[model samples]
Target: MTLTRRDRLVVDARAIVALGGPLLGNNLSITGMAFADTVMAGQLGAVDLGGLAIGAASFNLFMFLGFGLLMATSPSVAHAFGANDARKVTAYARQSWWLVLGLAVLLFTGMRQADWFLPAIGISEDVLPVAVGYVHAISWGMPALLAYFSLRYTSEGLGRTKPIMFTGFLGLTVNVIGNWIFMYGKLGAPALGAVGCGVATAISLWLMFFALLLHVRTHRAYRPFDFFARIDPPNWPVLAELTRIGAPIAGSILAEGGLFVAAALMMGGMGAVTAAGHQIALNYAAFMFMVPLAISSATTIHVGHTLGRGDVAGARDVGWIGIGMCAIVMTISAIVILLCNDQIAALYTRDVPVRELAATLLLMAALFQFSDGVQVGAAGALRGFKDTTIPMALCVFSYWVVGFTFAYYFGVYRGEGPVLVWIGLNVGLTISAVLLVARYQLVTKTRLGAAVQRPI
Candidate 1:
C-alpha cells in the first residue's frame, strides 16, 4: 500500500501526538510548579518576587543544562529499543545513573555558591538575601530531581510517557500544598517567603523521584530489562559514550539558557520593579515554550526509533512533520499572547506597574514564538540522529554571539530597557530557526543519498 505524502504526514503526525500528548501534560505540569512559585511569591511583595526571579534564573540555568545532558538517554534508549536490543537499552539506562549523579553533585555545589557571586553581579541588597536563601534551600533536592529525570527520560525513550505524566501531576499537587503550608505560615510554620517556595519544590522533587522509581521497578513493561536487578559499578566506556553525546547538548542548553539568565540578572540591576516585570513576562513565555518543547522531545524519540530501524526516509518524514507541528502550534500561541497580553500579565502580579511592564514585554515574547518553536523543533529532530556537535556550535553562535550581543547593546548600552532586550531575543531565535532547518535538510539529504548508494 503506497501512502501519498498527505497520508504519510497524517500517520507520522499521529505518532508524534500520541507520544507528545502525555509529554505535553507532563511538561505543562512540571512548568506549572515554577508558575506556582512565581504567583505565590508575588503575593509576598515585589521584593520577594524579584528575588525569586533571580534565584530561579540561577537555578534553572543549571537545572536545564543538566536536563540537556540527561536528554541523551532518550534518543540512545529509543534507538536501542527500536533495534530490539534489550541489553543495550538496559546498559544505557544503568550507565545514565552515573551521569545523573555527577551532574547533581556538580550543580548542587554550584548552587550553594550563589551567595558569593550574585552580590558581585549587581543584585539589589534587598533581593540578594532572598536569592541566596532560595538557592541554598533548593540545592538540597538536586540529587533527587536529577534522578527523577533519569527515570523520566528513560521512560520517554521507551515510549512510556504516561508514568512520567502522572508523576508530574503528583509533584505539582505536593508542591502547591507545601508552598501554602510553608509560604503562608499554615499549620504554625513560619512564613519562609521565597525560601519556602524552594523548600516546597525540593520536597516535591524527592517525592516525585520516589514515585517514578517505584513504577519503573514494578511495571511489567519494564520487566524485560530488569533495570533494578542490581546496581552495576560505573561502566567507564559507556559513561564516556553518554558524555560524548550529552556534553554538546549541555553546552547547547547552557548557551541558550545562559542568555536568558543573564538577561534576568541584568534586569535585576535595573530595580525590583523591572526585575519582577521581566520575570512575569519571561515565566509565561517559558510556560508556553514547554508545549513545543514536549513536541520536540517526542519528535527526537520518534525520529530516533525510525532511524534505529534503518528507515532513513521515515525518520526524515517524522522530523519535518514535528517541525511543522511546532510552527503551527506556536502561531496560535503568538495570537493568544497578542490578544490578551495584559490579562496574562495580570495573572502573575497584582502590582499595576509590574503588570504593565510585563504586558509590554509579552508583546515582544509573542514576536519570537514562531522562531522559538522552529528552532527547538529542528534541534529535537537533529538530536534523534545523535547529531549534537554541530547543532551545539550553531546554538552557541545563535544565542551568545547573536542574541547576547544584541541584548546587551539595546538593553544595557543604549539603556533602552527590557522590551528591546526581548527584541534581541527574537532576532537570535529567528537566526537559529533558519540555520537549524537548513542543517536538518542538508543532513537528511546526505543520509538519504548514502542509503541509496549502498548496495544491499
Candidate 2:
C-alpha cells in the first residue's frame, strides 16, 4: 500500500496539531519556568529581584538573536527528509552543530560583558553583583541550551513531537524543584539569591538536553541518524545555507523583541517601578505571542514537507490552513486579555499607578493580537517553501522602520506614552502580514509554473 506523493501532503486538523504538539510543549514548560522563576525571585528581596530581571532580559536578547542560527536546523532537516535523502539530513545536522557550537561560545563570552553594559542601561549599582552572577551562571549553560535546541528540531524534522512534549514537562518540574533547593536554603542549599535562579535554569536546560539525547538514541526512527557520532568540522556551504534561511526570522523576531528591549532601557531611566510595569506587560505579551509562534512553527513543517515531496497544491493548502488557525486562536486570546486586562495587570504589582499603566498597555496589546497572528502565519508560510531572504528583509523593515519608529514617536514625543508603543506594533504587524503573504504567493506560483513545465 504505497502512498502517492500528493496524498502525503493532505493536512487536516490532526496533522496540524501533531506538528504543533512539540512546540506547544516547549512553550508551556518554558512559560511555567518563567512564572515559577518570578514567584521564587519575589522572596529574594529587591536587589536580587531586580538582578533576575536584568539577567533574563540580557540573556533573552542574545538567545533570541542567536535563535536565527539555532532554529535554521529543523526546517533544513525536514526538507532533506521530505526529499527522502537521509544522508543530506545527517550532513545538515552535523553542519548545524558546528555553527551552533561556535555561536554558543561567542554568546557565552559576550554575556560576561553584560555587567559593564547593564549599568549603562540605568540598572542600579545595587543589583550589579547578583546580575553578574546571573551572567556567569547562565552563560555556561549555552552549550546545553544549543544541544537541547538541536535535539528538539531534529525530532520535529522527522515529524515527531510527543517526545518534546513529555521532555518539556519533565524539565519544567525539575527546574522548579531546583529553584526551591537553591533559592531558599532548602536541602542544605546556600540560598544563592538571584544567582540561584541562573544556576537552576542552567541545570534544567542541561537535563533537557541529555534527556533528549537519550530519547533519540533509543527511538527507532531517529536511531539511524547516529546523532552524536563523529561530529565533523564546520562545512561552509551548509552553514551559509542555514544562515541565509534563518537570519531573517531572527531579524524579524529581533525587530519585534528589540523594540521592547529598547523600551525597557528607556523605562529603566523612568524608575524601577516603571521598569517593573514594563516588564510585567512585556512578559504577558511574550506569553501571548507563543500561540502564533506555535502556529508559525507548524506552518513551516507542513509547507516544507509538502514542497519537499514536490506537492505544490498541498503546500498552498497548508499555508492557508495555518493562517486561519492562528487568526481564530489569537482572536479568542485577545478577548480573554481584554476581559481580564485589569486583573492580569494587577497580578504583578501592588502599586496602583503601575497597575493602571499596565492595564492600559494591555488593552493596546489586545488590539494587535490578530495582526500579529496574521504576520507570524504569513512568515511561516514563506518559510515552508524555503524562501526566506525577502521575508527577512521585510521583518527588518517592519520592526525597525515601522514598529520602532512609530513606538518612539507615539510613546515618547507625542505623550501617548506606553499605550502608543503597542499601537506601533499593530501598524508594523499589519504591514508585515500584507507583504509576507504576497511573497508566499509569488514563490509558490513560480514553483508551480516550474513544476508544470517539466511535464511529469
Candidate 3:
C-alpha cells in the first residue's frame, strides 16, 4: 500500500520519536548523575564544587574522545541491519569491542598523568588535590565505560534503545546512593567530598556496563545478531575502517567539548564562585541538550536505515524532520530556561554570587539553545551518511578559530566575565548551525541529483 506524503511524514515523525524517546530518557539519566554530583559537591563548599567542575571537565575530555571513537559502530551497525546483513553487524560490533579496549588503555594512561599537566594548565592549588583525586578514582572505570559505550551504540544502531534507557536509570540510581554513602560518609565510610563523587560515578559505570551486557546476552532481541556466537580477534581492516570514520567524529566532538572545557578552566582561574556559577549554568544547559541529542541520534539511525534501503529521498526527509524537531523542542526549552532561571540556579547552591552569576548565564544559555540544537542535529544527520571529515574541520573552525578566539578576547584578555564568554559560545554554535545545515542540504541535493542521473 502506497501511503500519501502526509501519511509518510506522520510515520517518519512517529519513528523518530519512538526511537528517540528512550534515547532521550537515557541521555537525561546520564546527565542527572552529573547534576546530582554538582548539587552534592556544592553542598560541601565552593572549593569542593570548584574542584569537581575542573575534574569533570578534564574527565569528559578523555571520555568524549573514547565515546566519539566508539560511536562509529552505530551507523555501521544500522546500515548493516537495515540491509539485513546480520554477519556484517556482528563483525562491526566485535571490531568495535577491540577498538574500545585500545581506547580504554590510552584513556586510562592519560588520566593517570592528569596531575602532571593540570598544574601547567593553571589549575589552582586549592582545587588541584581534589581534582587529581577525582580523576584517579574515576579512571578505574575507563574499561567498563568504554565497554558500555560499545554495547550502547551497537544497540542504538540496531534500533533498540529501551535497554539503554533502563540501564541509564539504574546507573543514576546507583550513583545517587553511592554519593549518599561516600560523599557524606554514611555507612561507615569516611566523607570523601568531591573525590567521592568520582568514586560513585566509577562504580555506577561498571554496574551499567554489566547490566547492559547481561541484557544483550540474554535478551531475545539480540539473539539473532549472534553477538556471543563467536569471539573474533582483532580485524585490522575493519578496525581501520572504523577509525577512518570515527577519528573525525572524535576530533569534532573534542573541538566542541574543548571549547566548553576551556571556558570552565578559565572560569576556574577567576575564582571558585565563577567556576561554580559556570558549572551550574553549563550543567543545566547540558541537561536540556539531551532532548535534541536523543533526537539527533534517532535521526542518524533513521537516515542510515533509509539509505541502506536505497532511499535517498527518504533519508533526506528524515534528516530535515529531525533538525526541525530539534529546533522546535529547543525553542520550548529556551522559554523554560528563561522563566525558571533563578529557581534553577537556586537548586545548585546558596552562594549569592554564584547563584546570581549562574542565573545570568542561564539567560545566555537560553539564547544559544536553538543554535545548539540545530548544529548538533545537523551533525547527527551527517554522521548517518558517514560524512564526518568535513564536519570536523567545520567544527574546529567554528569552535576554536571563531569561538575560542572571542571567548579569550572578551573573558580573559578584557576580563569581561562569564557572560561574554557565553556570548562567544553563542557565536560558535550559530556559525556551526548555519554551516552544518547548509552542508546537509548540499550533500543530499548532490546525492539525489546523482541518483536521478544514474543509468537505469
What lDDT would each prediction earn against the true structure?
0.92, 0.77, 0.93
Residues 1-456, model 1: lDDT tens digits = 999989988998999999999999988988899999999999988999999999999998889778888989999999999999999899999999988888888999999899998998889887889999999888898899899989998998998989998999999999999899988899999999988999999999999999999999998999999998998899988888888888898888898888899999989988899999999999999999999998999999999899989999889989999999999999999999999999999999899999999999999999999999999999999999888999999998998899989999999899998987888888888999999999999999999899989999
Arrange candidates by TM-score, highest first: which order? 3, 1, 2
In order of appearance, the predictions have TM-scores of 0.98, 0.91, 0.99
Alpha-carbon RMSD of each model: 1.0, 2.8, 0.9
Model 1 CA deviation exceeding 4 Å by range: none
- The regions of model 2 sitting more than 4 angstroms off are 1-10, 42-51, 124-132, 413-416
After TM-score superposition, the amount by which residue 329's alpha carbon in candidate 3 deviates from its true location, in angstroms, is: 0.8
TM-score, candidate 3, is 0.99
Off by over 4 Å in 3: none
Candidate 3: residue pairs that collide: none
lDDT of 3 by residue, 1-456 (tens): 999878888899899999999999999999999999999999988889998999999999999899999989999999898899998999999999899888989999999997896888998888888888899999998899999999999999999999999999999999999999999999999999999999999999999999999999999999988888788999999999899989999999999999999999988888888898999999999999999999999999999898888888888899999999999999999999999999999999998998999999999999999999999999999999888999999999999999999998999899998899999999999999999999999999998899888888
Model 2: lowest-lDDT 10 consecutive positions: 5-14
Better of 1 and 2 by TM-score: 1
